[model samples]
Target chain A: MSDIYTNNYVIVAIFLILGVLLPVATVSFVGPLLRPKKPTREKQTTYESGNIPVGDSWVRFNVKYYIFALMFVIFDVETLFLYPWAVAYKELGLFALVEMVIFISLLIIGLIYAWRKKVLEWN
Target chain B: MNTLLQQAPSWGTTLWFIIAAVLLLAVVLGFVTYAIYFERKVIGWMQLRIGPNRVGPLGLLQTVADVAKLLLKEDVRPQHADKALFTLAPILAYAPAFAVLAVMPFSESIQFADLGIGLLYYIALSGITVLGVITAGWASNNKYSLIGGLRSAAQMISYEVPLVMSVVGIVLLTGSMNLEDIVKAQQDVWNIVPQFIGFAVFIIAAQAELNRTPFDLPEAESELVGGYHVEYSGFRFAMFMLAEYVYMFGMGALITILFLGGWLPIHPSLDFIPGIVWFILKFSLYVFLQFWIRATMPRLRVDQLMSFAWKVLLPVALFNILLTAVVVSYQNGMF
Candidate 1:
């Protein structure tokens, strides 16, 4: 059993390395060999539908995206709590069930608060 | 195969593992090539167009030719773009897309790593692709690309919650996170019947995760003008495209394992058909459904997309987990 566990992770690591190499190699080595490399001032400029660009594009974005990110962080952590409960549900039985129900209800209450506040309304 | 894994560590086994990884990469590359062809043909037929017949026989070589052309195009990096990050983003995105496939069990005999936490491994690794997308968008230094990237980040991160929640019902029922074990638990009945709501939520969230039609606000060509990949061209662009299709394959296989019973025959009496064939059939059904939806549906408004993920799908998925838990406990007479 321990052997298979070690073998499984070894294979996973090898594949991860290969996945990174495959695309990087193709784009850097093989791509340059075959593709054209001519560069003009106009061609190199940041594309804005054939017009001269304005100020830097890395300007501040809407704060609503940050709010959504916060919501995601909260809910994502909440979701992780269910996994251990799920795995041991049979052994833990109704007690675990009631506990999860309480936990989920609290999160739901939070979701509803966000809903009422129009945090979810996506203006 | 279990015996193979149990063998003592040696150079031969290491070589074998390397060979297997390469072969799997080849198979995935082939699958991605034809998946693109298949998507075009399916959507073309739906739209009453013949679609790409000029490239090869029945357009069989269309994607192949397209890939070659992309490979041979100018690899342009826009001035003022973050050059290092721009180059690195494709690798970051494409790597996770491929790595997630390591955990997908195609059939009983055809699996790579049979990790006990296979489902969690898949979900965790799949999340990394979002970083690549956002990085590509930020590194592009283009307004449209930045917005597209942020939009994708928001959409993927939001939809991921419901996606995970939907899968939790199955985990509760199977009592195991190993995908193979989950499929084995479905021998008597597929989870789709009892967990139909999860299935629906999974399908929706999975589509949004893939950033396909209706949820493709990030790359809504009509709006953001190619979205996050707008500044990408040549081989770099192809890597992003490949990642999307590869992720589709991974997601399709997952839906098969979770709801359609993986490679299990539709009925016990149908056991004469091989499991791999059943796996392919179910997987094709999913891929076809993606194309069908793409052809018929209009893209959702960005606001509607966000609301649907948070407001509609997340709650329904939560309800599914609750219902499954209650029913399973009752069945065990623990209530």
Candidate 2:
């Protein structure tokens, strides 16, 4: 593994070239055989069954989803720290338990904010 | 297979590793292409439709043909897009996914860069892939693309926490972040049995991390219309797809390493296949499972997705980590 990491630029170049080329090679070799000629405007349109697209692809979404996502961000950060501490639970014992309580309490506070805003509900 | 290179001081060892990694990377890349073919085939089967039967035998070469079309197609760059970032974004999207191939323990003899903190590096590198999405979105000056990219960055970053936290349970049980070492730690029993909650949370979070279905709101086709890569054309789009599939395999590798016991044969007392074979089998199974989930489930609202990861998965992961640490210590007589 150490030896693998120690390889220099020429090695790197060869690897990079292989990475770039193999996909290209696969395409070149196999493509012509499967070639389907593209003709008219119909071929270019995005496929949504047979009907033409209803509107321009772009559409506005509800801002409430954004609010819910924002609330999730708050709780998720709280959870990440809990993982490391959980691993050390045996050695840390009571201290870990105490700390976790404090951490979760903060998350609960955020949950309260979401509850008050009714962000958790589906519209 | 673990034989040390006796003949090498510097040049020879370097030459050997370089040759081997190049060979492996080629194989892995081919596997990535085939994986795309496999995904289409399997998903088609699940959806009860024929996929790419005409492209090659079993439509095996369909991805190859599509690659050619992409290459031959005109490169479409939006006029207002930032030239530098637009060009650079694909690399950002792609490279980290490949770099993660380093820590995945395909075999005891395999693995390119087995750093002690392999999991940490994998997560860190993956997180940066989000930046590429944002760069592509913001640089494009296209509003839909901008919203898509921003949505992705926000969604991915939000879920990243639970993703890492879920893995913390396995890391706790094994007492090492080096994937190979962690697998070896699970020599007695696969961590999945002991850490089921962590396993479940990790799998869900990983699905979200890959921006996969049910959790794929970032590329939500209904409203966003091709989403973050909306403006990219030609090979740039191919790069994004390739990166995504590679990362899917990478996630499979991580799940296998931490939870499925890496290369350790599932059957005790009888070992026919090498550890590498087990690793590949397990990894491929998980990858297929991802496709299955995609086929079966409906996309969740972005809000619901985050709450599921944070409220549901996060707590479960923490609980598993705590439980594993205690159980392992007591059993080992550490207490």
Candidate 3:
């Protein structure tokens, strides 16, 4: 990569490191110095609205989230395709328009299929 | 900063980059502190109640005081919690929220990283926050936090589609994902006017993505009991709070860039005002709208939240991109 391009990301990398450092420093080092450290067994127990906790929380959650994740992956890929096309749209002109229309319509059809399959519903 | 981007790697440039990043972090922290104070004051006034009067003048230092208290409180971890992930979650969530600001052009000259794919950088980093939320919930080993985390993950991902799709209209119009180019392309007219459908979809999806009221399903307090951070206390909890507000700041700046014409005065005659002032004015309008909506709107049902994103916002965003593409091609005499 060119100096400019490489330098741009260098700035971003610095910012990311600083971003991580801020919360880590505050929550661990700086905070530990100032904060109290009184921990009882009850205080460290998982809270369940003041009631005694029951089964483990790591049990299987509703499958709806996984369904949404599948839908998201599909649509997210569609979005990825759309972005590059959109960025190049001015140069590509009418040919790209027709192609994108066909592309999006196909995804809309997939969305409709999901709707019909009732995967979009919360229940 | 632009000049620095053209230079080869060196200790001097690296030191300058570090200094710039630190300065920007200070500014962001200032923004977060006052944003919380402003949100409380705005919502409190709307509810006809006084807010934070005991802190500094006109409650200006309310959030500062609150942060001090949070830092002083004991950090607690549930006994069964995954210790490493629990400790890591807040940093994971917050780092991206702050890092995304690197690409945000505060004015024509004020951006830090001048990445070509600035919009993509922002979107990609913001999405990582959902992972942090899921980790916090799973690591907490609490039922409410687990449900909250899953709900939030689902909500964030669902809205994220529409959010990215909606901006494709602007990307199509400007033919560039670099935010500076997008803003410069709006010299004649802002994207919101021609890309009205996209703007509408973007704002709605942005609201959901930020988890503001009317779309705040993941952290629904009444039912979920403080949601994903229910098990987090003290400085760790403060990290989540800071991330949420900082994300709001980022989204506000982005909306200003994509739709509101970042730092562009409404009229040529009004150009005497500095660009940064115009930027702040437009950005503050967005921040205020967030608070106003938070005060006014009721939270949506979980099912309603999911359906609305997939059904309403997604389709609208898709239609917007198609509409923008057709119009742009026609304007280019390609029809």
Candidate 4:
């Protein structure tokens, strides 16, 4: 059993390494071999609809994205909790069903809180 | 598959695994090539325009020609951009998109890693693509790219909730996270019937995940001008594009597995047609739906997209899980 688990993960690891190498090898080696290398200063400059860029493009973004990220972290973790319950649900029966209902309801309440706080509002 | 896994780690098996990975990669590249061709032809017919008849016979080789052009074009990088991250972003984006394919059960005997946690592995690995998107935007040192990346991050992460939640109903019904088990449970009937609502949520959330049509706020050409990939050129741009189509293939295969019953014929009487063909037919339906939507629907506004995901899809998905749980327990005479 342990051997299978380790082998499964080993296959995954091999795929991961191959995935990274495929693109990196193509771009660095094969791409440069065939692609042109003309890089004038004007051509290499930042694109701003034909106008010379005035300031750095890395400006501060809206705070709303941060709030969305925070909400995502909270909800994502909560979603992970559902997986375990779902896996064992058949064995747990009615008691598990009621417990999950309560758990989901509490999360719904948190969602409602965020909704009311206007954190979900894109603008 | 389990028998292969059971054997102690050996060089022979490892060699075979490497060969399989390479073969899968070639197959995916071919699929992406034709998918682009098919998308153009379908959309062109919808819009009353000729798609690509100039390349090979009936434009079958158009993607090949386009790929060649991309390979031969100048590779550009902005002087002010973060060199290391900029170079790494496309690899980051494309890798996970391909990596997740390892868990997808293409057919009964055609899967790679038949991990016990197949579903979770797919969702988790696919999520990493969002990080690559953000990195591409931030590294480019371009405002539009940054906004596009941020929009994608927000859209994908938000919709991911409903996407996962929608699948919970199926997981609950099957009582297993294994893709093969999920499909086997649907041997009598596809999950789409009992889990129709979850199916709807999954379709919508998946479109958003793929950044297709209505949910393509990240790369909205009008607003963000190619989104986070605006700064990329030549083969780098091709990598991002490859990632999108490969992900489409992955997502289409997943939808087939989860809802339509992976490799299972519509009717058992049609079983003589072969399982791989059924899998391809179902997978084609999803890929076609994506292009049809792309040609027909307009993109959603950022605010509207967020509200739709959180307010509508998420609640509906939760309700689906609750409904499925209730029905399951009732069926089992637990009530």
**Model 4 interface DockQ:** 0.77
> What docking tier does model 3 reach?
high
Ten residues in a row with the worst lDDT in model 2 chain B? B1-10
Off by over 4 Å in 4: B1-3
Off by over 4 Å in 3: none
The stretch of ten residues in a row with the least summed lDDT in candidate 4 chain B is B1-10
Model 2: lDDT to the true structure: 0.71
* Interface RMSD of predicted model 1: 0.9
Per-candidate Cα lDDT values, in order, are 0.91, 0.71, 0.90, 0.91
B314-335, model 4: which lDDT tens digit per residue? 9999999999999999998998
Per-prediction DockQ comes to 0.84, 0.15, 0.81, 0.77
Q: Each model: TM-score of chain B?
A: 0.98, 0.94, 0.98, 0.98
Q: Is the docking of candidate 2 incorrect, acceptable, medium or high quality?
A: incorrect
In the predicted model 2, the residue pairs found to clash are none
Query: Comparing candidate 1 with candidate 2, which one achieves the higher TM-score?
Result: 1
